[model samples]
Target: MPSNVRHLTSAHGDASFEACVVPYLDAAYNLARWLAHDDADAQDVVQESMLRAFRYFHSFHGGDARVWLLAIVRNTFYSLRAKTASDAAHETIDEETHVLVDEQPSPEARALISVDIEALQTALENLPHPLREAIVLRELEECSYKEIAAITGQKIGTVMSRLARARERLKTELSHCSTEACRHDVR
Candidate 1:
């Protein structure tokens, strides 16, 4: 095992924390990145959350560590955002600038990757924060409703409701894209 895991296991005397919490680093980072919308902010959130979790490891009562850590991450992110509220309004990207431009694949390798996936990801990036976050957590992260609830600090029912609404909106958006593509083909 790694040194950090060894230290965590020995220092806290909690094997479960090392096993469960350490494994969730990628998921935690992904959530933070999606919420914060900046690589540095995401790293800061995850680091702070890990430190807090390590300090409070003993208080954890055998619940799912992913959900527990995610709760901490969510809280830390919102707190940081609140502290930086003055700068928030200034950093917003213009919507028109986010429109996807069809970039041709380089001459060297056109057959390896699908253009549709790139287009889909660009569309996903264009979604509003709430819908995008919901889709990332529920669909891409494969988080359960309970886990998503803990991460978002919402009730499980609310997470479920939001996920349902998000899926419907994504479906509508994708269908519209498909229709536009078909019309362009005919023309």
Candidate 2:
């Protein structure tokens, strides 16, 4: 290729990635964090995915940028997962780790609604990876079933089935939480 052609191609790729892929960075990070289950790992996944996306930018035709980036993120997370199984097995836990502190506490304690975010997070974390991903993509990320199917490389029907199963499991788990909360309330 000629030098100017090469330069223009590189510029096009850079502009495409910045315009199409960069906007989804936060959403991509959120997906990565949920999939990887660690902030550092999630960050690594997002970075690697973005690099891969940029390298392959020519392959991307105009479409939903968020879904395309998320697809890349999902694949990267799985690749990382496969490579880190042994490391994950021997990982140590700290008591203070993973504690979510609300930075700006809501001043409205008028009704004291019991949502049990910790329980929900635990339930989501315990779900099988496919189910968890389906839920995260569909519910949390507000992706359509078709979008999720493309991102996850699954058939739309399969995505629907997984989401249904995930919701059922979440309901079962959240019911247990509610029961405990009810008992505590009555006491």
Candidate 3:
């Protein structure tokens, strides 16, 4: 093997990078899923992001691995968008790809849940990328404003403004849901 070849373990026999990244795979997938809006595309985004993170592991000083990896996920998604607009434009989330907590709800109950999920996802999808990112980071991932700003390379004020606008847009778009979950979520 060439000296420059990267492996799962570091040169000094440390697996710190891998260790740091493994726990956040689901978080990475969730972000990618939200941004790409399609299962296959989200998988691609996460794979590329993981590769990039490994390739750049040496450059990472000590910090929150989740934040660092998520930033990479965001960049990978945007790069894909820039390179192939049409590939992304037509893609939508495939219901079969996601794991449901319910083992097998009744057909009618499943339909209702699907409708609720779709409404929420569509509202999020309708948001502009910046606003969507803000909302996802803050609301879903529960990141603080400072952390979002750090990951996004934006001023804290910009992050706050985006979150505010995203929330309002989601509230208006989700007005029809009126369900307890939606009500509890959009505030």
Instruction: Work out the TM-score per prediction.
Output: 0.71, 0.80, 0.79
Candidate scoring better on lDDT of 1 and 2: 2
How accurate locally, in lDDT, is each candidate?
0.71, 0.79, 0.79
Q: Candidate 2: where is the Cα deviation over 4 Å? A: 1-13, 87-115
Error of 3 at 152 (Å): 1.0
Candidate 2's residue-wise lDDT over 26-85, tens digit each? Answer: 889888878877777777888788778877888999899999989999999899888876
Ranking by TM-score: 2, 3, 1
**Highest TM-score against the true fold, candidate:** 2
lDDT for model 2 comes to 0.79
Question: Ten residues in a row with the worst lDDT in model 2?
Answer: 89-98
Taking the tens digit of each residue's C-alpha lDDT, what string does model 3 give over 1-187? 1113234335545578768875687888888888887776777888888778887988999899999989998999999888885754534657666426585799879877877787887789889889998899898998899889988899999999999999999998777566655667645
How far out, in Å, is residue 8 in model 2?
Answer: 17
Pull out the clashing pairs in model 3.
none
Q: What is the lDDT of residue 166 in candidate 2?
A: 98
